[model samples]
Structure formats: C-alpha cells, structure tokens
Target: MNAPIRSDATPRLEDYPYRLSDNVRFADLDPNGHVNNAVYASYFETGRVTLMKDPSKGLVPDGLAWIMVRLDTHFRAELHWPGTIELGLGVVKFGRTSVTFDQVVFSQGRCVASAQAVTVLIDETTRKPVPLTDEVKANLKPWIRRGLDLYQRD
Candidate 1:
C-alpha cells in the first residue's frame, strides 16, 4: 500500500506569509445562500494586514494607509452557511509604495477561493505613494516570492 503524504511534506500555504482565521457569519451569506463574492475582498484584506504587520506588535505609525490599486478574485468552489475558514496570504512584490498580495481561502483544508491585489502605500496626509521602509522590507522579505519585483512599480 502507498503511504499517505505527511503533513510536513504537504505544500503549506502558511509558510510564506502565514494563515489567518476567518469564521463565516450569517451575514456573510447572501440571498443565494452562499458567501458573497464581494466579501472575499474583506477576508483577503484582513489576512494581508495581519501578515504584513502583526496585530499586537505592529508596524510604525507613520500615518500611512495601503490603498488598493488593483484586485482580482477567483472562486474555486462555493462555501455556504456558517463554517470556519482559513486565509493564507503571501507577498508577491514589494515596491516603493506598493505591494502585491496573493490571498487564498480554504474551507477546512481545500482551497475554495483565491485573490490578488496591489496596494499602494501612501502618506495619510498627502495620499501619495512613498518608498518602503527598511523595517517593512525586513518584515515582509521572507514572505515575498522570488522575482516578484521584475515588474515596474507605480
């Protein structure tokens, strides 16, 4: 008989940026009785924030916000009703003032949804794109996929 794949050998989505919790609520479902596609954005956003900056010991308060420049969501399967979810996030590209985030939602252990977004960091006052801090680079370096910065940054 063939042996089952070990958990350690499994391609862990959490290894890159890490996984976050997502518990579906009644409101999460639409009239169609499944989680709304739009709500996937929120799930991804929360996961990205937590991965880039820890909640308790977070990033410097330089008065900055990450504004989405683009977003793409792909639904692999339908998830209806209340259930626990896991959101895995990873940094694809890090730029002067922007970062590409790839997010995936797993129902139980299978990927049910996926999303990608580019968020440009900006000064809260000027709302203009700014350079990335070394601190942020050090924090997110491990999570970023290799060659993600081959493209230009806006």
Candidate 2:
C-alpha cells in the first residue's frame, strides 16, 4: 500500500519532525481575501518554535538562544482566507552550533508554500553561536528521520 501524496509533494511524518495545523483568520487575510506572501513567515515561525520547544523533549536550552541565521521560502500557490493549513517541519542537517530546518506549509492537503532555515544555537545573554550539547542532540534524535522516508518511491 502507498501513502497518499500531499498537495506539495512533501514527505510524510515518517520523514519529518512534527506537523501542525492552523486556520486563516480575518486578521491574516489581505484585501484580496488571500493570505499575504509575508504571512507564510509567521506561519513557518510558529511551527519552528513548537518543534524546538516541546516540553517533553525540551530542545530549547535554558541559557541558550536558537536564532535564525538564514531563511528561504518557496510558494507553490496562493492560500486564501478561512481554511485549514498544515505545517511540516524537519531537521535536514545538524551541526556543531547550528541546525537546518525544512518547513513545508499546506492547505487542503496541498503544499502552498515551503521554507528552509539555518538556526544557530547561541548564548542567550550574548547571542553568540556556541557548540551544540549532547543533551540537546539526544532529545532531537527521535525527531530526525533518515534519508527521504517521506517520499513514496525510491
């Protein structure tokens, strides 16, 4: 049996970290009645924090700051008002002081936009990049999926 393909052709939870769903609000819509291009940033940021701040796993360090070093987004189609949107987040790379996240946003089971970001672990006070600790890595491991298990085919 094959898993259903998502609208944006992204991998499933087996290939990703966590998935979150949201609804477009009156405040989120532009005069055109569709979500604005910039709205995706806030949507992406929402899932980013949740994935790292899971209280059970607690990836966010007490004295550390996980700051965004880079962000890139791709829009597959325009998303309009008053609908359900799903966000998929995964770690594609983990470094000594940073991690790369692949975040995909979907509506009605189709990907409307996606983004990739590089986040650096930093000293909360000084805001400087620091070495990633094993404790943080340990909590993050369960969320890491090898290769492209999200893909339906080899």
Per lDDT, the best of the predicted structures is 2
Q: Candidate 2 residues 8-93, lDDT tens each?
A: 55544445557888888778888888788888899999988888777777788789879898988888888887788888887666
lDDT of each: 0.70, 0.75
Model 1: number of clashes? 0
**Residue 109 error, candidate 2, Å:** 1.1
Q: Which ten residues in a row have the lowest lDDT in candidate 1?
A: 1-10
Clashing pairs in 1: none
Instruction: List model 1 lDDT by residue over 36-113, tens digit each.
Output: 998888888888777656644344346876678888877888987779988887676666677677678888787788
Displacement of the residue 126 alpha carbon in candidate 2, Å: 2.0
Which parts of model 1 have CA positions greater than 4 angstroms off?
Answer: 1-15, 52-61, 145-154
